[model samples]
Target: MRTLDHAACARAIFESIGGGENLVSAAHCATRLRLVVADAPKVDQKRLESLPGVMGVFCAGGQLQIILGTGTVNRVYEEFIKLSGLPGAPAAQKCTAPVLPLPQRLVKTLGDVFVPILPAIVAAGLLTGILDALGRALPAVAAADWFSFLKMVSGTAFVSLPVLVALSSARVFGGNLFLGGVVGLCMVHPTLLNAWSVGTAENVPVWHLLCFNVKQVGYQGHVIPVIIAVWLMSRLERWFRSRVPAALDLFVTPLCTVLITTFVTFTILGPCFSFAENCMIGLARQLSTVGHGIGALVMGALYPVTVVCGLHHMYNVIEAGLLSAGSLNIWMPIASAANFAQCGACLAVAFKTRDPKNKTVAIPSALSAALGITEPAIFGVNLRYVRPFVCAMVGGAVGAWFGTVTGIGATAYGVTGLPGFLIVGGYILPYAELLALSGGVAFAATWLFWQDVPAQDKTPG
Candidate 1:
């Protein structure tokens, strides 16, 4: 295989997106170069996709995302930044793309706040799964010093997830990350009772402030409250900075922001949002168990629809709530099923299609989907042909039912498909079966129902 020319690739991307003048700001994730351009219509998206080493291109949540895989995306991003004379760090860049509706904007904000921190969560989750497997398989080792050390390492992310969420939220909301971290830390302060222990704790400590009682409960394993608190902190900090005299701004802004936010958080945001989050968690749990996993079946089928709409990252909130409440991530299998089913559908397209171009795209896209990244397969192959997408959804629903009945769960989130094996613990066999069932069904269904339409005859969807 030929090595990618990072500088040339970046230059090509820069030109195709209408050069630096059209570029508003840029950032990159594990597998894609995310750009906010001055105008979406100015972008030569087709040219970008045709460029060497680019896997695919699409627009979602008011950003142009170009898929370039992992390490390659980073290198290309660095070169692109150099060419465009842009900052390497992502600042509070303003998007000029078409304004999204209120609900869509909220979903996009959740994606922005959560996407940056998913890597750490995914890493910790993988470790947690491995450690659990080790502890069960080697009971003696589970009691050793090394084992205890590993467990601590594995559990830190989930235990301190609030802090991580706050930091990311701060970045997204354009506030001081360190200050946001303080907000997160305050929520999980050692002095307060752990949120997870609230149900069992006989007597909970409370503070009487201004004719109201505030519970001294830590927000461990919670996501929404931390995000809201940090968002409020960001807004307050900005408001204070703008009005406070320059001489006193430095000291007064942070102090006022923290104190006021903390007061409102413990008294209002924490109680209100945590209650709402718990309700959502409860509802999700009920759905997973209702009518013999019928909820999972529905969710599994609908999961890809959310992805298409760029709303799937919101599931992270629910998954976090479940894990924080001391429950396994039962949601993982549904996602895995949905993703692998897409892989199966794409693979069938690759095998059945006579066109060399279709085969070339489908085979690698299917492999990518199998590894838990489905955008390439979904956008590049399956969705392009309507029948395959529907078939994959059916496969996902069936596989999800089977997985729910088997009762497989994961210790962490942000992983699915083959890499999921690392965190499924003892459910490895069941997960493999789940994959085979989902993929097999999708493959068979697509083979029977989907026809390879020749390029000249294919209609635009």
Candidate 2:
């Protein structure tokens, strides 16, 4: 026996999973070592679970995840990558399974695309919130000449969002990064009026295409069109690479691919997709107005499904638009409810579990969930038992209804659970009430209905 040394165990895991050659990418979230591998079936699940340090193993979101507590997973991950000899873990993380339905695959694709950029967006959102709160409290600063400079810190990321999305999307879609960047920049070109400013004018400048005229608006914070354009560009670039002669391929492929893609973007992709995007935004707004908080109830119940299905990143579009327009993100409260519900459920499991190892894992995971990181609780504790996860969702739905009826929202983009109080700020009272409604109900229900599964490792040696 290896006696569970982290490095030696990591090496065993690497080898058992068909070695570094089989690995397409490596990443971790909270408490799990997440891998997107070439052959998931080749990995020995029983052998992995039997490993001394590993707490659990499962596949979700097209990822092979090994749960090793948060602090422990980081150390093991560092060792695993060092042994694999990969360059600083795979930066291009796109999780997909041929076996999955198209909708699920799309969800994973969208999540992977935004994961790299979400942190910056979240930071910008927090900065914006802080400024908003400060400006209200201190009128002097709001009137200062340099207030715009302060706004820029938070405003720049959201305004130039397409560029950030472009950089990531090109890599994920296998297109030329430089060309993709150029396309994104073109969408937000200084010459074109900002997307938000379009409404202020009776009629903005128009571009005449073959059939119709476009509003000559910048994409600014839009999501879907930039993605569609990049996907088309990547496909075109690949097609050109195959046909063009090697001598001509270098220059011809780059120039011809980008030129064709750019032309199609202005004439077709941008305008059509922008309309579709606006319709979706309009639908979300309408849902907010739906009677008796029904939309909130449905969204709260389904929000956890997004996390499970890996579609949660799709909300980045809606949330960004809301914050940019000065309305706080309505989704944030639902997110808080869903996230804290998981924490409540996890804590319930911790209190009920008799096994020392299960107890050890559940306690910290609950803490992580309350702090606005829920995967540790979701994967390691609540979902493992099944019943608690359901209880959490029901609780979340109830909390969400309250939040919606009260019109509670958060100033920031990403923070959730207890820590969301920072962004909830003025909305804290109602937000905290929602958390209590969600978490208290979830914890009590889970505690009453759930029981711990006996751990084999807990048996006496």
Predicted structure with the largest TM-score when compared to the true one:
1
How well does each candidate superpose onto the true structure, as a TM-score? 0.93, 0.87
Tens-digit lDDT track of model 2 for 1-461 = 22347898789889878897788778876578888778878898888866766767889756788887757788888898899776534442533356567887776667667778878877887777777777878878987768778788887887788888888889888888999999889899999888878778787898787787777888875788888989999999999999999999989998998888888988889989988887877787667657788888888777777787667877777776676555678878888888888888888888988877677778878888887777778777777788888888988888888888988877767788776776765676898899999998899999988866567643211
The window of 10 residues in a row where model 1 has the poorest summed lDDT is 89-98
Estimate the TM-score for candidate 2. 0.87
Each candidate's clash count: 0, 0
lDDT of each: 0.88, 0.80
